[model samples]
Target: MKKRLRDLGEDALIARLLRGFPGGENLRVGPGDDCAVVDPGRGLLRLLKTDAIVEGVHFLPDTPAAKVGWKAVARVLSDFAAMGGVPEHLLVTVAVDPAKPVAWMDGLYRGIRKCLATHGGVLAGGETSRLPSGAMISVAGEGRVERKHLILRSGGKPGDLVVVTGRLGGSIRGKHLTFTPRLNEAAWLVRNLRPSAMMDLSDGLAKDLPRLAEASGCGFEFGEVPATRGCTRAQALGDGEDYELLFTVSPRRWIAAAGQWPKDFPQLSIIGRLCPPGQGASLAGGWDHFSP
Candidate 1:
């Protein structure tokens, strides 16, 4: 029997498909991290990211098309935030049934424009396609960050204290559609804390934390994860689409960093530590694209 994607899971499938792709001298980072980093010369590093939202997978049939559009754009922006980059331009591709209302498309674009205006980006262009069933929106964008500010998932070190911005869980209770991307919080961290490593939490802490640790070639030891007001610790760890920032700092630096955290932003919580691979306990289960 042929090997199935469900068996391999999303991460392993991605690794398998991207294996042996040639890297150019200008490709600073590729594939595995939140955004692909390119050295565009000068002092700037170009960030490239693309994200998609499907009607059934991301939003319900009655969910506002505008919110869906906002999510599509915001998701990419979150990735840019993870890389400490500022979005400059975007290209949006929309796939929907031809029978869908024109008003829906209008609402979607309105949300897209609003998101770009709020977060800083231009809707350069995009494509439209006919889908047999539900709607899908995909946004691809480019951003820029200075070399000094660039953060990658692989930069973490053992003994680094793991921190997360904002509360987690309860996304299904409407936060998923409305939560703000952590652009400002990330900017603050880059300027003030300079986390040893960072990434946005889209796939739940249980899933994404391991990815970050694996990328950094370390293992993680976690204690408390802050849950949303009506959520439990398990939900906080397993509920995907939190859209908060997950980052690491040196244990010695965490005290000062925590003390300097801005009052305007959402709360930051100390959830864990990154330890040498063999010494840390393992976590199991979260959101997986092909897993049942």
Candidate 2:
């Protein structure tokens, strides 16, 4: 019998299996964070992000193979949505044990095709190999936005209102696997409000917001954080994988445009404000895979 992933340990498994993957070329920043960044140059900034789902790390071994496939694609799409970019294509790579049926691969591909079709994205190309040990799926998404429209974590200014689209937390209940990518909402926002800074809440506001603040060279203050249906204040602030857009906008426009937002996405709400240089991030806690 083969040793389980748990027996090998997460760090050991990553170092052994993933450390040898190729690197360089357009990869501005690679794995080791919430998402990887690939710069396409200075004109139409092409953002590339990839995510993976393993049999044990992301889902139960018995989880539906189709849903597993969908989740894999959704993860990367959500990153593009957060960056306010339109997904144009995807590259999918899969590693499967010899024992898995070919039908399972078919089902996974079907799920990926369904999601790409729904989002108006095309399947590019990818690599496949026999894992001979466990199952793994990786997806690389390519998206683009006008250089001026590309939002980054480093654009907030003092007095700017911090806003969030949709509620947060308790994603594991069901939202994790079924949530829709906020691509439409993000595009609309970029075209209309022109957020000063923006990013998705993947590692929870606690960990992510501070990073944004650091990038923008500012601090933040949250007076009222909007909560999901059954989410507590703590959960709303610290539960990772919310996939909602967190942004900052000038106070004047934020207040003026609040009422004008689309009715379909009424959940958009001002939760805080960018503070002066010394204030720093108030909410400072979230999920860290290797943290004890």
Candidate 3:
């Protein structure tokens, strides 16, 4: 009997699909982290990712096109932020009905432009196509990280402090469309105190936390979770698309990093601590695409 995709779950499905591909010599990172990394021998590693948003799937049709476009660019930029990298160039490929209103397309590009300009990147160029149903916008983002400064989700170890940038939960209530990526903070953290591991919290903590733990060969334990206003503790744990930064550091380094946390940057909090596998860890209730 043929097995349905639901049987494997997202993470397993991804791993199964990626198992046979051969990683090239210069490929420093592959399909696992926020971005794929390539070494060009320039003392820097290039960050690459392609992300797309479907109209009805990612946003309501009634939502503003500008916000839709902004989300498209921001999503990719957030991945760069996760890896302690800086975006340099963006390529936008959009699919829309040929008859789509002119104003709608204009607004979308306007939003995309603002994000690129704000984040020190340029919209070099891209291709456009006509699609049958809802519009689709894809962004190919390129960034760079100092070879030594690049952070991965697999470097965490036992006894590290699990920290988060900004509050969690309630992203579906407009936060997902507007929350800024913590690029500045990620850069500062990686430069000053090397984190054991890090990643942007696009999925809820409940789901993403296990990902970090599994990648790092560790587990985690936590007390109070920082829930956002109008959000329940469960939502804080399960609601996806927070886009905040989740990272780990040695407890000793965290003390120094905390003391020097930038006053102007987003608030940082120690939400948990890492431990040996099967220790105090919670991995329940998160978005699963194939859940029935």
141-223 per-residue lDDT for model 3 (tens digits): 79999988899999999999898888889888897776677788888888997898999987799999889988999988987
lDDT of each: 0.91, 0.79, 0.87
**What ordering of candidates by TM-score runs from best to worst?**
1, 3, 2
- Which residue runs of candidate 3 sit more than 4 Å off their true CA positions? none
Q: Estimate each model's TM-score.
A: 0.98, 0.84, 0.96
Task: Report the error of model 2 at residue 252, Å.
Answer: 1.4
List RMSD in Å for every model shown: 1.0, 5.1, 1.4
List clashing residue pairs in candidate 2: none
Total clashing pairs for each candidate: 0, 0, 0
| Shift in Å, residue 152, candidate 3 | 0.3
Candidate 2 lDDT over 1-292, as tens digits, reads: 8876656644356668876789878775465433455666666767778778888767666767777777888888878877778888899999988788888888788888888878767889998989977789999877876766677777899888889888888887877776778888888888888899888887788887877776788988886778788899899888877888889999887766767778787488888888898884576577666554
Residue pairs whose backbone atoms clash in candidate 1: none
**Stronger candidate by TM-score (2 vs 3):** 3
Candidate 2 segments whose C-alpha is farther than 4 A from its true place:
1-43
